[model samples]
Target: MGQDYKEIAIKLFKQGKFDLAKISFNIAFNETPSDELLAFIELCDMAKDSPSDALTLFEIYFDPANDDSAQSINEIIDIMQSSVQQSTMEIESQNAITYADFKNLLNQNDFRTLFESILFSTRIIITHKDELFELVNFLVDHGFLDIGLKYLEGSAKMFMGDERMELMLEKIRGKDENSLK
Candidate 1:
């Protein structure tokens, strides 16, 4: 049964159906836990969350004995950076939002950075929980409930067992439910 799921996951992964692949990989891991399968699951999760970081994930998971991959990964990073620059240029031309306003907003609140970071990255190393909870409440109060919910859902595992995180998760979940009505 585990092998069956693993096969399905591999196929899904090759097809770029990362979310489905992750689901299948999780099922496979639960049935017959292996480090390789777990790594694949992690890759699938990362791929689903940040498709642009796929090469980074590949570098992390691959064997260190192979050295040729570094140059290729560097090239991929360069290409990605170029693409991001082009997108930023396009956005700058079209959007009315000014750099000063964005800078001021970020400077005005530390949690806003946390919200933006968690929105993009699957994992973020955060040392401050007080600021995180404060940001969650601020976002929720300011009608950024969807962004707050996404950040909480993504970061909940890392901050698990903290009463504040749990409470905010519950609050965001309730808000999400109500908003759907």
Candidate 2:
């Protein structure tokens, strides 16, 4: 059974299905722990952690007309990567902008920054309404209710009259209420 899981994970990984591969690898590890499974798990984690992966997920969830957010996120990632590589030593200087500063910029209503932050921090694949609801649930579960609320509100406004937005708001409200209980 462990070998079956490992084989399935390897096939999924080769097919670029990192999330599914990670799950299979985790199951295999539980049955029979192995360094190879651990390595695959690490690789999946890295793939999922990439900003590009998040951008792809954003594209999958949002409408084509809303590509502006994804574009802005791509630009931010490019700028961040270049700046970091060019001034590795100057990162500690005031000239360098840390990730937290970037989040602050988003909170300041810098439109591009806000969208970029959403794409970077939330690996949300909002394909269906249920998926969007799940993303909000995840954000709340992870103690990012405030940030998640902001993004949900922003998305609701961006795609005005979206029924899913209302549903998501209701679900989030329920989660908030439950948490306070």
Candidate 3:
């Protein structure tokens, strides 16, 4: 990595310029994902200055459908949960933001963009029966069927217990495709 890139990454991180820092770091890390750089990034994450950014980064690092990384998903999940617990943003700060409000929000186009971002990141951790069940059930209850389908597809890989797939296949067997459309 060039000295200028490192300087830019650090400056952006310090300025709370996370997305920019992430872009810079990706370029820099591409050249050298050395322990020093990785540790520095982790330090910035644990600094708790940007809870949502940290959580989102951790989510991308441990995707459920992709087990190609050297880092353990559990460790990443631990970090994400920590960030979530420490997040300062209100989950219901918008006007009339109830559970129903969030449900509707999840279905919105903008929210789907955010949802897809998280899905890409947390796919790995979300595949566990307990986690996947909780996540999918939450989205389903909130009327986010698109999110539910995404989680269900990922969780199916880990859900190898009974003939549940068979049962599910049966349930959808007689459904009217035209009506669904």
Candidate 4:
């Protein structure tokens, strides 16, 4: 019975149905208490709340402690990647929401609040050079110079020697300088 619930929870979790997964994990925990099940419950809660937080929790807490850490980490990574991919696809499906529309959104809402909400909630794994470039450009253009620079610097290893990435770094630096002036 407990194993049955655990299996259901895992399936739901992989499907990005964290709410249902959490309930299933809870039921499983009640039936057969274990640290592993408790961790899964906590992971489901965090993933439901925010994928970024879930990834952080898994990296900082679960990965180090678990005996079967590799499998656990892989599962969490899969969930985060899937969620990010789905979000990316949705944004793409909307035709990338024209720059003017996005600017309007930023103007109507507080940009800092909105940007922070996205930055904290989503674990953006840039799968393409274009995605990184576009994201850095958007951040810098929207006055998130520091964040843009941080992202550019962090991605430097992956994008090293890429002309577009170099141009983006220069653009971010140029913006940073102008802002300081």
Using lDDT, give the best candidate's number: 4
In order, how many clashes per candidate? 0, 0, 4, 0
Return the TM-score for candidate 3, rounded to 2 decimals.
Answer: 0.29
Q: Which residue ranges in model 3 land beyond 4 Å of their true spot?
A: 43-181
Point out the worst 10-residue segment of candidate 3 by lDDT: 88-97
Candidate 4 lDDT, tens digit per residue, 97-180? 434444566777876676676565444555445666776787888888888888888877766677987788788878878888
Q: Give the winner by TM-score.
A: 4
Candidate 2 structure lDDT: 0.61
* Full-model lDDT for every candidate: 0.66, 0.61, 0.53, 0.72
Give the Cα error of residue 23 in candidate 1, in Å. 1.4
Off by over 4 Å in 2: 49-181
Model 2 lDDT, residue 99, Cα? 48
Task: Write out the backbone clash pairs for model 2.
Answer: none
Q: What TM-score does prediction 1 earn?
A: 0.35
Give the CA lDDT, 0 to 100, for residue 29 in model 3.
73
Q: What is the C-alpha RMSD of each candidate to the true structure, in Å?
A: 12.7, 14.0, 16.9, 13.9
**Which digits, one per residue and each the tens of the lDDT, describe model 3 over residues 49-100?**
4445555554455468767554544455466567555432343232222333
